[model samples]
Target: MNEKQFDKIKNGKGFIAALDQSGGSTPKALAAYGVQEDAYANEDEMFNLVHDMRTRIITSPAFDSKYILGAILFEQTMDREIEGMYTADYLAEKKEIVPFLKVDKGLAEEANGVQLMKPITNLDELLKRANERHIFGTKMRSVIKEPNEEGIRAIVDQQFEVGKQIIAAGLIPIIEPEVDINSSGKKECEQLLKKEILKHLDQLQDTENVMLKLTIPTEANVYKELIDHPRVVRVVALSGGYSTVIANEKLKENEGLIASFSRALSQDLNANQTDEEFNDTLEKAVQSIYEASI
Candidate 1:
């Protein structure tokens, strides 16, 4: 990325909204928000929705010109040839939009008296998929851990290894060490999480243009402390597992540039309006965060 590009992202005040329209049934609430029911039925509909959403966000005045729109591609969306072609076509058509590829197989779980995460056990497969995504004008965004030391190490290692491959392939990697709100408590937990995250960053010898996804600390003081870290290039606040309204309010109250919001936006979709309405609401929500940041 060039200096101009870096500044645009660093100074921009908005969140990167994610719609997991990959496989699971589209929520009824989201269907009511104008999302096509068929969109979630197959990969074709999902890809179209991705393109439609991107175009809508970029063209909207609510989202700043410098802000970036990211789409999350899941396992179901990337499994077939037709869906991949659609994704590539959409990405090629919109070269400027930042596309993110989700790498984790699934959520982490506890087993055998040890916290375990579904790791990207196949490095070659991951590389191949990432290369395909690159061909479609999208970069890779991998989530490393949920909220544990072991999980964090696994994520950092994967990021370090994948970062090398992605850079060699001429792509950007969005490194995320997501802290689970379920395991998080007050200020002390936030501090420990920040410390662990920073430790991981320190271990990345050649890491470049890395982004951190963290739950917005419940305490403003902790949030400020974490944001002030010198090693943290960009901070994208997580929307927590809550409503977009609440997430938007938190983003508004917090001081951060990029917000990674997924579940809230997807859960709000209603089928009453057209695709345009769904996109409009998303843009509005993002703009609310941008304005709040300013």
Candidate 2:
């Protein structure tokens, strides 16, 4: 590991504060939009879009100033070996940017009052892949499913095991526990989510060099509560489902320090927006945060 580089990441509160205001929304959303059932038909177009989006982001003021922007890679999007190679190459070229690998296959569905567990059972394969990613000059992050106490415990155990493997291989691990809000009211959900997060972090003590990627609660106070946790070292807010613009605005409002935005920029790319337009919007957004902090 580059101690100097790692130190830069560890000491970057202002940079993270800027990133919290903008980064993750573009990649996750774009992956969701581009990798639909028939998306493979337009592989070239999708790859180009990803390439353009990456370039635009890295050139933004945030990247230049050393903000830690994280991105997650979904299996659906990189199912092919060549696709995975491309992603690794792209990420390796931009080693300063944090690139996360999404391991949970998908959301577990509730059936007849019973929630199913969506575990990435192939631990060796996942770790092997993450190791390959490290060789290419970037670290990895994974997402754990939100389930009942038993399920959550299982998820935490699995993640700790994975974290150990990641550290042995010299990679950073991000433990992302996604809070489900579909069935519960927003305020109630946020409170419960906070409790769950605290519980998970406590269990994660044995894991070294770990960060938390949490979903921003719908309630403002709930967001504040989670952000205020003394044990919380780093917080990367999710862009949530489909609403990238709204997500970006909300992240900024909540003082979230990092974002993995994908959807909003994908829309702009699909609409054939010019590079200038995309760059201008990102610059303005980042500038707003920078100026506000000053």
Candidate 3:
């Protein structure tokens, strides 16, 4: 990634508001919002629900303007016009919040008992779209479901390879190697993922800067070493499935690491709330995550 572009996102309050939920994720969110069971029956319906959720989120006072530096958006909603303006355009125009796209097609079939993201096809074309939309970066996911070093290595290899391509197209890449927090041997998986990440990162040219979005490791300050690496623009932690309270607690101990949380950020929000309650709820979530970043 270009250091200049990376700097804008890495500095300040380095919190990413991840609103890029896929079809599978939408149903769960709808259930939490107490949407009727019929709402989850069709893909189109799911997108509509997700779109409405995005409307509430983007319009909320806490989003795109508070301690957030950027947002990672689902493809369908990235340039989507809400009211009379595009979501990305609205954020940039009003809040100075950067926008990023989620590019990978989701997980592939498990390899050696671990899951990796499917490569993005026509990625150059997608980057062209992102550039056109004024999005500054991209995020893709791969999960370490098991503690196999070889498997994690494969995942990181693919991430770095795709990441280089993203940089070539002038967008920053947030390489996510998420470890399943509830799985057996979580700490071991974290160690394996970290080691494999270093393998790809150490081999990159000095001019290429990459950002990491890893699951929170069991040990606090475990990622400080990565932050010190010159090639790494910033090291960010995902909340995974942790409650906001627990996520914030773990995040506070890790100096130099910021949050890129999705669920934890929205866990308390619901369509049932009044505007005042919704804004207050979102503000508290933002404040907690923001304080952890500092």
* Model 3: residues with Cα > 4 Å off, grouped in runs: 1-5
For every candidate in turn, the CA RMSD to the true structure comes to: 5.2, 6.3, 1.9
Better of 1 and 2 by lDDT: 1
Query: Model 1 off-target regions past 4 Å?
Result: 1-7, 21-69, 75-95, 111-116, 135-170, 184-186, 221-231, 275-280
lDDT score for residue 268 of model 1 = 48
Model 1, range 148-230, lDDT digits (tens) per residue?
44545555565556555554554455555454556533344456556665666666556444556666666653556546665
**lDDT tens string, model 2, 1-294?**
545445544445432321111123334535543433244345466555555445455445444353333345543323323323544445435445444455544435653222433565775677567555542112223333333455544444555566556666666655565554353444544454456556655654443465555565565535555455554445666554536556666666565445544333334433245567656666655454333222
Each candidate's clash count: 11, 15, 0
Alpha-carbon TM-score of each model against the true structure: 0.68, 0.63, 0.94
Better of 1 and 2 by TM-score: 1
lDDT string for model 3 (1-294, tens) is 334445667676658888888766777877776676685677877788888888888877777455888888998887587777777787777767778888889899888647888768879888999888878888999888888878988888889999999888878898998888887888888877777777787888876778899888898877778888878877888999999999999998888889989999999888788889888998999998998878
Query: What is the clash tally of candidate 2?
Result: 15
Task: Give the top-scoring candidate (TM-score).
Answer: 3
State, as a TM-score between 0 and 1, how close model 3 is to the true structure. 0.94
- Rank candidates, lDDT, best first: 3, 1, 2
- Mind sharing the TM-score for model 2? 0.63
User: Model 2: which ten-residue window has the lowest total lDDT?
Assistant: 14-23
CA lDDT scores, all candidates in order = 0.51, 0.47, 0.83
